[model samples]
Target: MKIGVLALQGAVAEHIRMLGLAGAEGVVIKRTEQLEELDGLIIPGGESTTIGKLMRTYGFIEAIREFSARRKPVFGTCAGMILVAKELSGQEEAHLGLMDIRVARNAFGRQRESFETDLAVKGMENTVRAVFIRAPLIESVGGNVDVLSVYQDQIVAARQEHLLAASFHPELTDDYGFHSYFLDMVRQYR
Candidate 1:
């Protein structure tokens, strides 16, 4: 099982470390061709606009859109979640728009507001300590998206077929369950 972590920016090392811990082959993806051989990909949290622009500057935006279109699993976190959101309100930026949802950027305020909380994620019984850093809260989910977890009436995590998005930084937490779940999805789909 080979997984590529979007090395454009943000949390790349953590995801690569977690993938190694999971006994899966991990690679940092920079070039467009690096995406070709992966079983799955992880789009980590960062400045959405910068990442999005870098993806295009590096000619990866359309490639990613195409990659996910084939029904392969891709898990996006935080800024990654913003990139995957179908529509973004109040933020002028470009994104992959792979997931069926709308997002509100900096929903939790700035970096100083960064905090952690235990969330009751679906399919995982234990309270997952989710790390939120300049995270975007999901405004609404489309009919096709499954609401996987919620916080304060807002959708925090969701899955739409092969695409998964989370408002928190699961990569920052010790819990690798979400990563494992995404890998399982990759295994099942592949």
Candidate 2:
């Protein structure tokens, strides 16, 4: 499967490496047309507002929104998670509002406050090491969304239909299980 990593900012190369290590062709998505060739897509962690703005500048926001509406699989991590939330309590006007979840940006504090933890994700056979950096905490989730993982009593990862949002960066870890699992979702949909 061909997986595209949003290259506007963040850990794009890391995700590409992870996808390549998973035995899939990975592409760094820059132009809007790149979205068409993707079987799946991963939105990497970075400044949410900047990435969102760049997506708009490059016209990728509309493309991604349209693709996602068609049931395409999209996984977002960290600030990417913030971009995909349906609502952000304090910054409603800034969020992309893709997934049906309410998020609180910088809920875990600043970069100096970043941390790592083991997440007990449902269906993940082993404990996944999650890297949280300026993470957004899931405040609430709509009924259709499944709570996948949690950290310190806050919802860190969730899935609402084809959209998967995680407040932590799984690509930073050595494990590729999460990436593989996401690809499996793409395979199921494709």
Candidate 3:
């Protein structure tokens, strides 16, 4: 399967590397046209405001939403989670608004509060390593959403149909469990 890492900002190469390690051909998606050849897409960590602005400026907002409307899988990490959410705490609009969840931006605090840990993701046989860096948290999820992992009693990972979201940077660690899991989602949907 060919998966894409949104290249507008943050963690693009790292995500592509992890996807490659997971046995999927990964591409850097700098334009909406690249979405045509991809079975799935990953929006990596970055500043939510900047990502949102770029997505709008580059015309990815509607394009990605249309892609997801077709049931193509999309995985969001860190600020990406904030972008994919339908609602954001104290925020006016969402970037993609494809996932049926509410997110709280930077709910995990600042740079000094960043940490790494292993997460017991639902449906996966073992734990996956996660790196949280000024990450957002899922404050609430709609009925269709499933909470996949949690940390310190806070929701960190979730899935809603073809959409997957994580509050941490899954590509920072050697564990490709999350990437592998997303490929499975793509295969299933494809």
lDDT of each: 0.89, 0.88, 0.94
TM-score of 2: 0.97
lDDT of 3: 0.94
Q: Judged by TM-score, which candidate is best?
A: 3
lDDT (tens digit, per residue) of candidate 2 on 11-129: 99999999988888989988878888989889999998889889888888789898798888999999888888888877736455789999898999998999988888898898888
Candidate order by TM-score, decreasing, is 3, 2, 1
Tens digit of per-residue lDDT, candidate 3, span 130-171: 999998999999998999998989999999999999999989
The collision pairs in model 1 are: none
TM-scores for candidates 1 onward, in order? 0.96, 0.97, 0.99
Stretches of model 3 off by over 4 angstroms after superposition: none
lDDT of model 3 at position 142: 94
List where candidate 1 sits over 4 angstroms from the true fold: 92-94
lDDT of 1 at 170: 88
What shift in Å separates residue 2 of candidate 2 from its native position after superposition? 0.4
Best by lDDT: 3
As a whole number from 0 to 100, the lDDT of residue 56 in candidate 2 is: 84
lDDT per residue as tens, model 1, 51-168: 9889889988899898998887899999999988889998665488788899999998899999999898887767777999988998988899999899888889999999989999
